[model samples]
Target chain A: MIFKIAWRNIWRSKLRSFTVMGSVIIGVWSLSFMLAFFAGFIEAYVSSAIENDLSHIQLHHPDFKKDKEVQYRLKDIEAIEKQVTSLDAVKAYTVRSLNNGMLATATGSRGVQIRGVLPEKEAAITNLDQKITTGVYFDATQKRNPILVSKRLAEKLNLSLKSKVVLTFQQANGALTSAAFKIIGLYQTGNAIFENLNVYIRQEDLSRLMGETAMIHELALLLNKKDAIEATQHYLSQHNDSTQVLVENYQQISPDVNLYESQMSVATYIMIVIIMLALIFGIINTMLMAVLERTRELGMLMAVGMNRSKVFLMIILETILLGVIAAPIGLVLGFLTNAYFGSYGIDLSSYSEGMEKFGLSDVVYTHMQTADYLLIMIAVAITAILGALYPAFKAIRLKPVEAIRKI
Target chain B: MKEVIKVQAIKKTYNAESIPVHALRGVDLSIQQGEFTALVGPSGSGKTTLLNIIGGLDAATEGSVLIDQQNISQLTDSQLIDFRKEHIGFVFQAYNLIPVLTAKENVEFVMLLQGKSQAERDARVKDLLGAVGLSEQIDRRPNQLSGGQQQRVAVARALASKPKFVLADEPTANLDSKSTADLLDIMAKLNREENITFLFSTHDQRVIDRAQRIVTLEDGAIISDEQNAIGS
Candidate 1:
């Protein structure tokens, strides 16, 4: 009977009830959309970092990451590559010989990290071949040492495709060396900071130039599934000499990526709290008005035998019914918005320059986990209950005699 | 006849701390079973206050109210609500039927609160609405019914719990002459046929003319208590 009465009572003032429900719908829609957008932004940032350079996992000579000297090369290059490539989880892998040195042209000299990579394997892992904008990737027909420089770096060096540049670095004996290489390709990764600091060259040419045969310093691997990364890294660790190797994933290699990933949920929680708080006050206001308007009716109910607890429960049921009617509509609206944007992403190309500086893609697709939807439903329920408390209590506190006598 | 209501030196003071308004002063009254009694007085003469105290809707400032030998003044507020549900029925002046419920539902509400099964409540609601001449208006809500029909529904609801007695405070104050006459005929018929006890606080001479006994008040004190041999 209470349920029936409460359900009918809300419709007594249809305008007021709908106004409260409209607030709930808008609150739920905005919260869900905002969280989806935040999730998309963070996903873009992390994936861009990984796809551009991080890969799923990377293995380095124990001391090589500390200093990019030629002397810290992997002890047995062939043996380690053989074991890593044989793992069932290994989707693709690449070996690179790294050297931090200076690049010079007739105009100026700038600091650079020269990455010596095998063309086929690097293409498979990082898709470096597709990033070429003007010239071809390292071709077997090239007669000289072929190098790939970013467009931003080429502008700094006053060089273009087929321009000759001199790379100056160190040998295993601590002697300084310089070699001339031809820039065969100019690539633009949209990340100005990374583009300005790094250039790629053929591994054979760099190894021969440093007076070592088959010398490699880093092994970057892309796994078939992200969840298999820790297991693959563990397998690689057991196969190799642990004292000479350090295997790490993208999060381990970049602390900022890890921080962004962990903070996504915190950001979502803050959004839920903010939206629910606003909804709470709106619901309380509406319910308080309902209770006050029906003072005589409530008093009569008590006078005729309805207890305080049942009256309290009836008010609570009314508030919850409002949420129950509004939440699903809001959820459906949010789901539709997410679906439309997810399939055809929202473009923010106008902010591309700024976004790329932080290694984030210009377009972000809105998406949310199933658990997120469940959390939102639970949050709305709690908010409704909390919002109903003061008004329900006020109703139960009215003395039947005084209330009935109220004129 | 057994005494259904016994009021012993009941006193009620409103705004007692500052400029106290004594609504009831040492009023004593006893009503027996199967009696149709009217408490009549001018404005501020303590008719409603005395009735409220006896019905357990308000606490007496001094003295006690016993309904069928139970001291209602000693009960807690929550306990008083339960006592009202189980023993006393009320018919308000404005026809205080739940606006959201149909006539039948309003009659069945108290029985539901009593935890009566559907079969029992349905049967009682059907029988009581028939008794009140609302047998055809069972599905209409209060707002849809006429003022007289609404009062009829209130009377049905008051009897739904089959309480020991019914308290009506000016139940015909809002009705037209025809509605008031029709209502008095129903109440008088019910008292005669069902032997139900009824106590009313009213200024309407129509109600006073039909009562078996009349209790009049002046200056918050009962000035006359008389039984009409043939109702005026």
Candidate 2:
């Protein structure tokens, strides 16, 4: 009955109730939308890096991860492959040799990152084979040098299907070596960083270029669960004798990962502070006014045998009611805001040059996440109830007889 | 006769702007159960202040008020609330019913606060509202009711707690002659029929004339303590 009375009191002055509710709704919506954007964007970024660029984990010589220069190569690849593939967590593995080389065809020549990989095994680990256009992917069962390169790289080399290209690089022994490979296919991967220079050939061709039979510079492993990369990596590193496991997907391992995470963390904290301040002030003002107006009412309640603490509880319940009324609406508004902006995106056409000056990406869009809405809704509910507590306490502490006399 | 209220030399002082305002000056009074007593005085004679002290709304500066021999001044604030809930009923001149509540709700609020079961509150509120001639107006808010109707609801609220005594602080002051007469008749009848004690502080002639005993005050001091040998 007390709850009913308090609930009805809010509607008795509908404007006051709505004003407080509106503030909470707006605060919750904006805060949730921002959190959603951060979470969603980070998810997208990691997926892009993992699937598009780096595999989930890599196995190489102990010094290879530290130096990253192509000095480390495994001579006995079959032994390492058998042990790694036996693990249930390893979805697939690819042998890759990252080499610095110059590509030449009739039309042009450019320095490129020449990746020597087993086409079938690389297909399972990396998205490169799936990106191949214009011709078939390289068949590992076939003869010598069958290479795949990006459309941009192939275009720069002026190579078509079955067109021959020369790749020149220095071997591990510091001897200059050159090879000719048929351009069986071309790929147009969207990343400009790799698209301009990325080229692929068979591992055998790379071994011959390095003048070391069956040598691999890097062994990259893919996993079904990206989150379990650390566990899988730890197990692989401890169990393996010759190979050192570098535990990272490209997305997880990026140098910019901390920068992005910290940026997101700071943004979330600021947004919460701004939102909670506004909401707290909003609820506190409403409840204070409610307290002042209900002075005599509260006193009357005390006169009727209500404990002062119970009176406070009743008022706090009213604030909780306000939060309840507003939170679902706020969640919907947040979702709508995120969906609208996430899809259509906020165009920075006017500030493109300004953004370029800062070197940030082109557009700003608010993507959605469940965690975002959850955090804001919880905060909204808590803040609303908390904001009412002091005023409620004040109202309940009033002297019943004095209050009755004053009115 | 059951001793309903015994006030012993109650004193109350207020400090307004650093000046001591003595509102009650050692007023001692008592009334039996089922007695209708009127406490009358002009404005600022501390008539209302005396009523507030007895109502457990204000703490007496010195001395004690014993209702049913329970020392009210000694009770904590919460205990005082419980005392008010269990033993005291208050009717205010402004007809101080909760304005947002319906006539029935205002009456039922007392029992609700007392932690009375729903059936009990419902039964008492309905009976009391009917007794105050407000059964039909039970659904209306204070604004929707006339001044007379609002005061009737306040009376019903007082009675709903079934306290040993009902204290009216000029409960009929804002009423017209007809409503005032009607309210006094109901209270007077309830006193006789239910053995419920009634006390009032009023200059209103109807209330004083209706009283079985009259205690008069002037300048925070009681001047006349007279009981009509022949009752109204």
For all candidates in order, the CA lDDT equals 0.91, 0.79
Model 2 segments beyond 4 Å from truth? A83-92, A100-114, A117-124, A129-170, A175-208, A227-231, A242-252, A258-274, A332-377, B228-231
Instruction: Sort candidate 1 into its docking category.
Output: high
Residue B58 lDDT, candidate 2, scale 0-100: 84
DockQ (0 to 1) for model 1: 0.88
Off by over 4 Å in 1: A156-158
Candidate 2 lDDT over A318-400, as tens digits, reads 89998999989988988888888788776766875454333233455777657766777777777877799889878977888
**lDDT tens per residue, model 2, B27-124:** 98888888888898889999888888888888889999898898888988878878888888888888877777899888888787777898888888
Alpha-carbon deviation at A200 in model 1, angstroms: 1.4
Error of model 2, residue A51, in angstroms: 1.8
DockQ of 2: 0.60
- TM-score, candidate 2, is 0.84
Alpha-carbon deviation at A244 in model 1, angstroms: 1.2
Residue-level lDDT of model 1, residues A1-407, one tens digit each, is 99999999999999999999999999998988888888999988877777778899998888877777688888887888889877889899999988889999989999999999999999999888999998989878987688999987888778998899999988767788899999999988766777888899999988888887777888899889999988988888888887888888999999999999999999999999999999999999999999999998899999999999999999999999999999989999998998899889889999998988887778999988878988999999999999999999999999988788875
Candidate 1 chain B worst ten-residue window by lDDT: B223-232
